[model samples]
Target: MELFGQSGNFVLINIVSGNIDFDLRDDNPAPCENIWVGNSSTAPTDGECI
Candidate 1:
């Protein structure tokens, strides 16, 4: 799956899996302001994409 759009916010629920991975990319490659990833019950405090 992929996401493409302008600035906005979103929430995901019951997204359970093993060894999940996230990648953020842009055609112009602008700096990413913020991103959050975690388990189904709680939010992640810290993580790195690259």
Candidate 2:
């Protein structure tokens, strides 16, 4: 899909089954700081910030 922000910051997470399409605008020129992709029902326990 698409996401927009005033601070030009964003994050994306894919849990199960799907595809992510990111469209960044030149006006913001910002990139996603963190991204998580997995297929686990439990949370991450490796000291991650999940």
CA lDDT scores, all candidates in order: 0.33, 0.32
In model 2, where is the ten-residue run with the lowest total lDDT? 17-26
The CA lDDT at 32 in model 2 is 37
TM-score computed on alpha carbons, candidate 1: 0.22
Supply candidate 1's per-residue lDDT for 30.
37
Off by over 4 Å in 1: 1-3, 10-15, 18-30, 40-50
Q: What tens-digit string does per-residue lDDT give for candidate 1 at 1-50?
A: 22355333333333533433433322222354234344352223223321
| Pairs in steric clash, model 1 | none
lDDT of 2 by residue, 1-50 (tens): 12344343333443432224322222332353334344242332221322
Give residue 49's error in model 2 in angstroms.
16
